[model samples]
Target: MTTILVTGGTGTLGRLVTERLRADGHEVRVLSRHTQPYAVDLREGGPGLDAALDGVETVVHCASSPRGDEQAADHLIAAARRAGVGHLVYISIVGVDRVPFGYYRSKLAVERRIEESGLRWTVLRATQFHDLVVTMLQKLAKPPVVLVPAGVSDQPVEVAEVADRLAELALAAPAGRVPDMGGPHVRTFDSLARAYLRATGRRRRVLGMPLFGKTYRAFRAGGHLAPEQAVGKGTFEEYLARRFGQ
Candidate 1:
């Protein structure tokens, strides 16, 4: 049995990974901001991490900043190496290389750092999750007309799917930049917004607003899709039905 350390274990993806790993008979430890025995924050380079990583053979790094956290990734990689950990698995967004946005750029930098470290690592790139869809719905709720960025296509995935894949990676040998993981079907931001409105019985016009910059261009170019990679199971309709139970 391997000892697994999962960062951001309290979040949606992290919690699922921890539970799955625990159910698989592995000793699982979580890290958070609070000063628990195994929990610590990554912003300050995570103090007391030496004790947290005691006997840990594998690390599933699910922690991240919305604006991206390169330093946090750097620190974790360095710490795991110093602790003589066997493997490090990182969860990344799908469009890092294509987008080159600040956050995506940070992710790429972290990925490069891991590759250059000569340590065993696996980087799993996943499309946006259902949670992102939920967030969009919440935004639409505020405005009578839902203004969305134009020309962006996505195959939004389930966070659980991402977690399961991370767990699978934890068990497999480290392979850099594995096949991408995405949702069941492709749709635009407009369609997603419309689906949410329809599901919630909210009447709103989804206005496709023009976008600018590399971020917008990247998304428009299908940077958010997994063209030939792993496809997710849950459909947006299925997700809404399960979430709303109707």
Candidate 2:
């Protein structure tokens, strides 16, 4: 059995990845900042990480922060190198390079670091999760009229599917930047909001607002979509049903 370490073990994706790895009979270690079996701050590069990396064969990096993603990768990569970890699997968002958002830019920077770390590594870029989409729609619904960006599309995947793929990658030899994983369906933002309202039995006016800037332009240009790589089995409707009991 391989000894694996899962960063961001407490987050949505990280927790699922950790469970999958454990179920597959690999020795799994969880690394989180708040509280855990191993409490390690990715931004600090402290002794906690050094201890966690000891004898670890593989590392599935799922911990990422909008502000300190690069810093966390720097520390994790350094510790992994020192510990002679066999493979490093990094979870990334699709269109990080294509999208002009600051968060995506930071993710791309971390991807570059992992590529240059001289370790056997694989980067898996996936579309946004269904949970995120639902959360955003819920927050926007609080307003009198839910306003969505015009010409933007969303392809959200199930978190469990991404977690299963990460476990598969963790067991195999590192393949650099594997094929992207996206949802089964690609729909416009306005349609998604409408579906969400219908699922929750809410009647809110949905408005498509013309958003300006390069970020919206990139998103409208399908920067966040991967129709050719849409391999996830679960649809957004199924996710809504399962999550909300619709």
Candidate 3:
């Protein structure tokens, strides 16, 4: 069995990936900021990272934040190199290169760093998660009227499916930049907000606002969509029913 280390092993996607790897009878190492024995903060380069990478053959990098991801990736690459890890797998958003947002730019930078790190690597770009879409709708519904960006759409994929794909990739040889994974449907933001309101039994008037900006324009133009690669099986309504018991 291969010894694989999963960063952010306690997170939404990482936790599921860890479980899958363990179920397959592989030695799984969970790395997080607070987890003992492997508690190393990737944002800061430290000795704990080296210990975590010890004797690890593959690493599934799932730890990420709104900021400091680039720095974290640099630390991970250096530590993996020192440990002689063979394969490095990364999960990224679909539109990191096309979208001009700060977070997307940071994700793109991490992808580039991994590509040129002189290590075998694979990167998978996926659409937004259903949980993130729900969180966004929750914030929008806080006000009496929910205001969503006009002409913007999203394809929300299930996190479990993403985790499953990562596990499969970890077990196989490194293949750089595999096919993109997208949700089954390309839905508008307002429609998704309405779905959330219905599922939660909330009454809020949803309004679409025409915002003018490069980021918004890119979103409207569907830079983040992967219609040709709609490989995910879950739907937003199904996810809502499972989450809210509707």
Clashes of each: 0, 0, 0
Q: Tens digit of lDDT per residue, candidate 3, span 79-165? A: 999999999999999999998989999999999999999999999999999999999898899999999999899999999999999
Writing each residue's lDDT as its tens digit, candidate 2 over 1-246 gives: 999999998899999999998898889999999866689889998988989999999999999886898999999999999999989999999999999999999999999999999999999999999999999999989987999998899999999999999999999999999999999989999999999998999999999999899999999999989999999999999999998899
Location of the lowest summed lDDT over 10 successive residues in candidate 2: 32-41
Between candidates 1 and 3, name the one with more favorable TM-score.
Answer: 3
Better of 1 and 2 by lDDT: 2
TM-score winner: 3
* lDDT (C-alpha) at residue 89 in model 2: 99
**TM-score quality measure for candidate 1:** 0.95
Q: What does the lDDT come to for candidate 3?
A: 0.97
TM value for model 2: 0.98
- What shift in Å separates residue 11 of candidate 2 from its native position after superposition? 1.0
Model 2 error, position 138 (Å): 1.1
* TM-score on alpha carbons, each prediction: 0.95, 0.98, 0.99
> Alpha carbon lDDT of residue 235, candidate 3?
98
Give all candidates' CA lDDT scores.
Answer: 0.84, 0.94, 0.97
Q: Where does the lowest 10-residue lDDT sum fall in candidate 1?
A: 38-47
RMSD of 2: 0.8
* Clashes by residue pair, model 3: none
